[model samples]
Target: MSSVVDSTCEIREAQLALQRDGEELEHVEFTINSLYAEIEVIPKGNCLLQEKRHAVQSRIFTNSARISPVRSLPTEILQRIFKVCLPDDRYVTPDIRSVPLLLCQICRRWREVAEASSELWSSIAVYDLSDKGSYTAMVTRWLVASHHRPLAVSLSCRDAIIFHEFPLAPVLRWWSHTQHFITFVYTATISGLLD
Candidate 1:
């Protein structure tokens, strides 16, 4: 489970890195092309053209050399990077997995990193999911790797009152012992409100 979470985290970082770098590359290319075109038509003694060209060239070189700072990130920095990968919300309907929690999508190394870093994936938020079996499994992995650290969980109204999510019963039973750690959201029902 740890390995699964780790890989998922790294893969997520890779994908975001690719998207960000790709955009920067495109912007740089466009600026360079526009400058080069203007330089061709500039008059012989144009100081503006010379300065613009120099600036563009400098930026091009700087950006080219820097594919991404993450490429050479230290271990502490990398862990920090993974921390943001975890989204505050967990149950987003179709996407069961959180952004930072999906490092397996990036590559093998990231997957390993995420798995090894239990804290990265220990946070959980309950919403509409009916089954807790899978969650229990995930919790176990997190519990073991979390080194006795308490896990963070957000309790939402839907999951607060034992919504008949069949899977939840087993999980509740399993965690009947550690119920205090998780946050459960609750709202007043019509009957409760009336009363």
Candidate 2:
């Protein structure tokens, strides 16, 4: 009789696990649908927007895998995986700690996946220096981003909403580093963006 009771409890646990998995599948389906839907919104004569989407999709996959063709992975990733790696910049680097923390916190497996993906950690996204100065703290993050691999930077503007802060040295270095890694630089100036 005790054995029969144990079997029933096991069956109930199995059902609960199955239900949770079904919910997870539903969430994944929604994400994919949204990505494709974004493509549908692409209008005519906007080749640049289309190209950006394609490139982003490609990066999403490449970074997730963690293995990059570079002689080394990016510095932001290194800073994340190897905490004591760069002692010089540790004191003032807000972006360095936050980028990986946010991505890894998305979920347990994603944290594991992001951790494994050195490429995902490679490139750093710089926030511009704003008039309000929310991004003053992110200087180290930019440095962390360009640390291991040559920098692939995106510069927003001289505007208040300076979305990125690319290191000048790495920019020059990456230009001479490799032809295979194409860096993209984007800008949305404050006057144009806010006005």
Candidate 3:
């Protein structure tokens, strides 16, 4: 084999490589410090931004809350409002003048509250006790509307009224819980109403 001699070139090449590596190390150190400083500032800046965002959101929520007049009302006041919407008489139907029916029509919440309320349906007035289908249905509905609460019934009939023949079965069924309060006496037909 022939002897090779490249030691001198090899040494020079090694020294040049060392010099470049030293410069690269210094540049890397500088870049690392710059990045560290930026990293520290970014979190603080983000924290301030977040604080501003939350403050603005809070102000917007407060302003929105101030706009609702009914939302701020207490539960007691809301209950009173519901009570005022009830009719003076106890028995009611879907007539426009019927308070319970009207209140139920206004909203879902009103319907729930009205239907469950015993006081609102405690007073019922029966204009007639005839065996006619509609009148019997109305009387039955009024009794059911009371919902186990004590009832005040007003019974009156214009013509000759008879107890056994009249639609008094449902009323008599609830007689234990009912009190006949008002009686409109006619000429000759409503004797069995109070009984």
Candidate 4:
């Protein structure tokens, strides 16, 4: 009779354990289903979040630029600052890599300030006018930017042929017509001519 009772108790324990395992399995399946549902909605939600973030970033950038100290500077002060940036060589060439031209390329406001500041354009050096048309146009533009200020010009040539071909008549005519005081310097280095 004791053996029969022991067998009955063991059978009852096994049934209870099987019921608990079934309940645990159902809970795990429900959790997996919930996760799948969330994954389906995540992409659209993520896109909306990204768009909001971008808008906020753009507003911050615009507001920061608007309140910048550089933008607050007066035109006269800015022009003075620009003058200090000019090269010490006294005569500037129209190279985009250099000060005056580089300043103009920065922004519209700087371009306006640099172009309007006659002092920055007062002295220019023209090197080897092999590109005659472009050089003339550039020289003309530089002179115009000088406005009524006194001008200093330097012309340098390495080859005699190119020097002779340089279109100087138009430049001379323009200078004669201007009321501003002008100083012109010409330098030529031919292999044998100087010796």
lDDT of each: 0.58, 0.53, 0.63, 0.81
By lDDT, the candidates rank as: 4, 3, 1, 2
Clashes of each: 21, 12, 1, 0
Best by lDDT: 4
Expressed as tens digits, the lDDT of each residue in 1-195 for candidate 1 is 999999999999999999999999999999999999888877765877898899999999778757765556666666777877665554221132654446645655566676666557456554444445775455554444444445555534343234433344565665554544545333322343333
- In candidate 2, what are the lDDT values of residues 1-195, reduced to their tens digit? 999999999999999999999999999999999988887766643787889889999999767755644325564554355443333431222343555545555545545545554454445444344423545434443344334554445544555433334444554463443333336565555564555
Query: Candidate 2: lDDT over CA atoms?
Result: 0.53
Please give, for residues 1-195, the per-residue lDDT of candidate 4 as tens digits.
Answer: 999999999999999998999999999999999999999999989999999999999999889888889998999999999999988886888776776777878778889999998889889898856675866666667777777888888878777776666656754665674466577887776774555
By lDDT, the better pick of 2 and 3 is 3
Each candidate's TM vs. the true structure?
Answer: 0.40, 0.27, 0.42, 0.60
Off by over 4 Å in 2: 1-99, 102-117, 131-134, 158-181, 190-195
Candidate 4 stretches greater than 4 Å from native: 1-63, 132-138, 167-171, 174-181, 192-195
Task: State residue 69's C-alpha deviation in candidate 1, in Å.
Answer: 7.7
What's the TM for model 2?
Answer: 0.27
Ranking by TM-score: 4, 3, 1, 2
Candidate 3: give its CA RMSD in angstroms: 15.7
